[model samples]
Target: MSRGPKKRTLEVEEIISLYKKGESTTRIAELANVSSRYINKLLLKHNVERRPRGHWKRKYHFNEDYFKTWSGTMAYILGLFTADGFISQQGQTVSIAQKEKDILEEIKRELKTTQPLYRNKSTGVYMLYMHSKKMKDDLMNLHGLNPCKSNNVEFPYVPQEYLHHFVRGYFDGDGSINFKGYTIVFVGGSYLFMDTLQRILNDKLNIDTNLVTDKTNYRLFLSGRKTIQVFAQWIYKDKNLFLERKYLEFMKEKTPLDLLEDRKFRNTKNAVKLRKQKFLEQLTKTNCIEKASSLIGITTNTSKQWLENDSDLKEKVNILLNNNK
Candidate 1:
């Protein structure tokens, strides 16, 4: 006599646990190695009220094809995921933990999923979880992200056209702007990752910054008002998505005229620095700091600052002056 395959046995607790954890019924069935009907029966036995049919399909719905190509939104989300997102051992479960629920809500809207946000009361962190095998595979194979990628994560190749959008996304996740210091910073665990960012920003974009270690992690710092403003313009270029908290804070400090003037007068930072040196050197010929500053079309105080920054130039000026005396 041919015996039928043994029926897969499932416990009520197992089904309930998956359900409470936001697993869809179909996914729960797959996890439990049973039919969806059996899972539903067990849920009913435990007095778990059934949601309307197809609720999970609707709630968990998202454009799984989102990561297939390099678009602005896709690039931004990928960058955000690189910084703050986590993939499970199975590579099917993905999550983002943020201190602000508002950003999570915005990401939720963007992913087009209704997955509920969970909070860790102890840490005051809000978590958004998403489950999709295809999405995970795209991130791993098409992109270079993998499970447990924190310290070893490498900078994924991004098209030059979409790079700024990707950077904005990463910045929203692992970066910050300090209005008080007129500073912008990005923090990551991998030295290579920080180095790559510095290379791109410094060499490609003409935005300069220094890289340093911030305790266990590494960081890149861009300080001073004009630099951060220029970076903000570059990162926020497309006028699309962002972590609104950071964006709104930046707007409060920004205005059109400020940027225009920064570009108009400064021209190139190196040029400005050299021009300052040129005028300061002219102090010997003018025999007066005020006259030299006037020739440079700048305030005398500003010329003094230029001298203060260059010890060699200052020493040369002092020697010429003492010789004249």
Candidate 2:
């Protein structure tokens, strides 16, 4: 007796693509018109790894009110959304990208969704994305985010109690402290969003900020030691929720004005005047070369040679050159 044609699995590329897009084993099987066990076998055959069973199980009965409440975690999620999340109208999907895997996992856990975070091998960027019309609607209607909200995004009305936490999250997303420049600066493409943040900084912490318009975006800079100190203290009050590296830098002992003054003092011409005074004095005298050479503890030949060759450093560096002969 002759058997029917042998069953062949779907293309390996197609299977891998669907799997990476957060498709479950059962869903992949259904899409391919094969049994779930067969799909698992194909995945193994193709060297595609499987996620944990717990990662594939759906936990919450997702609804419109799933993300309606205002909480610290919610505030943080919103902040992350503002910084890196994208809403696609075509697919009704919400996608967030980060280099850190833990953050992507945290977002996945908070949503209680059974979606895998996909990794971009080229950029090493991990993206946690899902398709949900409810989430897109919530963000659009509740938070007032637009489909393409790069340059026109606004800060949503968060509760008074959770506003600081929300701002902390936003800061973690886009804000950075320049320890070298002694400034706490927030950078964003949206002018309105940056302005709103400036207002929040003033009203919430009584810290003033300067708004600067860059070529591509807006910058809200809280310069000076006192201002940045207040900003750091207010935002980092509950340090557990923020990016640890940034928080640690903000909590560092050095003050902005102290660093600024140190830089200023070092860069000023007066700072080096004392050291060059003897050189200048010697250069002005009749035996100027000899005097400067004595001060520098160098022989007259090296000083004469250097002075004769380079006029710019004739006086200042004559004392620094030494002669062996």
Model 1, global lDDT: 0.74
Q: lDDT tens digits, residues 1-325, model 1?
A: 9977646544567568657766777656654567778788888888987777756533467767668878888788889889988776642676778887887787778778787886644467777777878888888888888887888888999999899999998998999876654667788998878899999999765765766665578867775557677788888887577888898767766457255322234659788777767675667676666545544445456667867997887787788778877
Q: What is the C-alpha RMSD of each candidate to the true structure, in Å?
A: 15.4, 15.7
Off by over 4 Å in 2: 1-66, 254-325
TM-score of each: 0.63, 0.61
The weakest ten consecutive residues by lDDT in model 2 span: 257-266
lDDT by residue (1-325, candidate 2, tens digit) is 9977545445567667877666666555643557778878878888887788747533323333545788777887788788888776455566777777876676666777667766655567777766667888889899988777889998888888778777888887787776644666677999889888888888887655666665687767665556666776676565445567777786675645334322122435664454345555555553345434434333355456656876776644544333211
TM-score of candidate 1 versus the correct structure, residues matched by position: 0.63
The lDDT, on a scale of 0 to 1, for candidate 2 is: 0.67
| Root-mean-square deviation of Cα positions for candidate 1 versus the true structure, in angstroms | 15.4
Per model, how many backbone clashes are there? 0, 0
TM-score for candidate 2: 0.61
lDDT at residue 63 of model 2 (Cα atoms): 39
